[model samples]
Target: MPGAREELIAHITEKAVFHGDFILTSGKQASFYVDLRRVSLDHRVAPLIGQVMLDLIAGVPGVSAVGGLTMGADPIAAAILHQGAARGVPLDAFVVRKEPKDHGRGRQVEGPDVAGRRVIVVEDTSTTGGSPLKAIAALEKVGAEIAAVAVVVDRATGAREVIEAAGYPYLAALDLADLGLEA
Candidate 1:
């Protein structure tokens, strides 16, 4: 049997990868798209994603929480939180809204107080690195020290360069080759 990471890759390749023309969040055109939600939200695949991602971010030290821009990052953070607990890692998860809520506390970063804590921004997949960058900005406003940016699948389309150029270490669990795709 394949290990957690390999199994997760298989799941993603089989269920998440879609071919043909597609427009990515980065406003770039692509021949293929990796819709991780197709498997990230699945019960069987979620745990696999959590395990694989945990291993991917193990090198980064002092990560108290994990999260990123809403929608894409939501499930990935939840998976890490649950799986980390199972492994006794004790990781908290947060959500970064595109914009601050107008009501209640009018907050943007939701969940535990990440203020002054180290966090790893996560996403299901990365294209141009815009989403994680946006999340990093919100996290900075709340005083969260970003340890790194982690993604499940990297399209190999300059996201790594964009993120590293912005001064954050970028980590990816899988890439286009791992999914039998190309940039």
Candidate 2:
């Protein structure tokens, strides 16, 4: 897990997944960024990420499944489910919609039935942690027990306090400091 985390950190630093000063969702801007899909699409990083995330939250009690909001959670969930099967742990995966649909099945939670199951939300990066919290509300509304939350990187914007205040442990494989970017 440590090696995989290190590899991810190295990739992010060297590749510099950044561009011009851009406005973040929080309307704040600096000189750096991390478009995780770049790493998520890399076959090597993808699988290694799955292993690392799984290990990070393995000690969280329950955890029958894994997932988060659609686009961000997609790759992580798939990787974790696949690797979990390989290791014989067999975790289910699901996606929480940004908004509940009004047509067809009219579902907000997609993939598997999360009701009565223990779940964890995953994020590629967390600044204020709003995205995962939205998923958490949707999941718990459907009766899923949230055991913890994990992120590949913490953008150092009080995410830990926000999540912990809501009574969920926030786990991170790397913070900005680990990448040599101070909080």
Candidate 3:
């Protein structure tokens, strides 16, 4: 049987990896993109993503929740919470909007109470780490202690440096190298 990492990678490789000239969220031009939303939203791969992400944070201490910027982080956070529940971990999940809502509460971070809890921020694919960093800032504003930044794929450009420079550990399940793409 394939290991969890292998299985997740296989699924991502098969379904999510894309090759094309595209402009990324960062406004940088890239020859390829790893669009994980396709796999993350799939019933088959979502649980696997959760399991793998759960494993990524299992050894870390005091992680009461998982969350990140909306869209990229949504499915991953939900999957982690679901898997955590099944395993008796009971983690809460949340989303950080790109901007605080203009209406009721005007909240940027939404979900269960996260104040005073350690959090793991999830991202689907990271290039410069802006999405996770935005999530981190929003979470921190509400007093959420960031434990780590976890991503499904790292483009291996400047994301690691940006994330680490901000004082949090970073982890990626896969990267451009894994998909045989140039950084």
Candidate 4:
């Protein structure tokens, strides 16, 4: 969480990026947007974002892996894998597809098999908590012993309760206030 959190947030803010004012995937409205893929694709920002997340979950016990829905969670998985491997934590990763890939493999979850694995679902943002919940369902279906759900930003929504009600812990590296960007 060291350099990555500060530097990555700075990059996102300085970009002054816009993705159009439209309904969010969670049906929420906002004056701004986070083009996560754009930021995640940044050669520098992506790895740091992943490292921040790894540090966010480092204290959590029984966490055998890190992962979540694709697109939002893709770079996160890769970053965690790289950091974990480097640190000898053996943190595996899995992807919970938006829908099962209908093509070859016919797979929904990708990466280390989650069956009975202690895992953590990661997300870049949380508005209504829908995305993380969907990933949770996918992991549960595969017998994944999910330890928790973590996000880089919480957006001050009720995502924490939603995840807690499902009997999994929730963590956020920063809330809207932390970056002085909250409405």
Who is ahead in TM-score, 2 or 3?
Answer: 3
lDDT of 2 by residue, 1-183 (tens): 457768877877766467567677677876677778888768878887787788887888878899998888888888888878888887999989999999999889998899999898998887787989999999999999998899877787787889999899999877888877754
RMSD of each: 0.8, 1.9, 1.3, 2.4
Candidate 1: residue pairs that collide = none
Model 3: per-residue Cα lDDT over 19-103, one tens digit each: 8898876788988778888899999999999998998888889999999999889999999999999999989999999999999
TM-score per candidate, in order?
0.98, 0.92, 0.94, 0.87
Candidate 3 weakest ten by summed lDDT? 174-183
Find the candidate with the highest TM-score and give its number: 1
Q: What are the lDDT scores of the predictions, listed in order?
A: 0.94, 0.84, 0.90, 0.79
Assess candidate 2 and give its lDDT. Answer: 0.84
Q: Can you write out model 1's per-residue Cα lDDT over 1-183, one digit (the tens) per residue?
A: 789988998899899989999987778899988899999899999999999999999889988899999999999999999999999998999999999999999999999999999999999988889999999999999999999999999899889999999999999999899989878
Better of 2 and 4 by lDDT: 2
lDDT ranking, best first: 1, 3, 2, 4
Better of 1 and 2 by TM-score: 1
Ten contiguous residues with the weakest lDDT in model 1: 23-32
Residue clash pairs of candidate 4 = none
Which one wins by lDDT: 1 or 3? 1
Q: What is the RMSD, in Å, between candidate 1 and the native fold over all Cα? A: 0.8
Considering every candidate listed, which one attains the maximal lDDT? 1
Q: Where does candidate 2 have its weakest 10-residue lDDT segment?
A: 14-23
Q: What is the descending TM-score order? A: 1, 3, 2, 4
lDDT agreement of model 3 with the native: 0.90
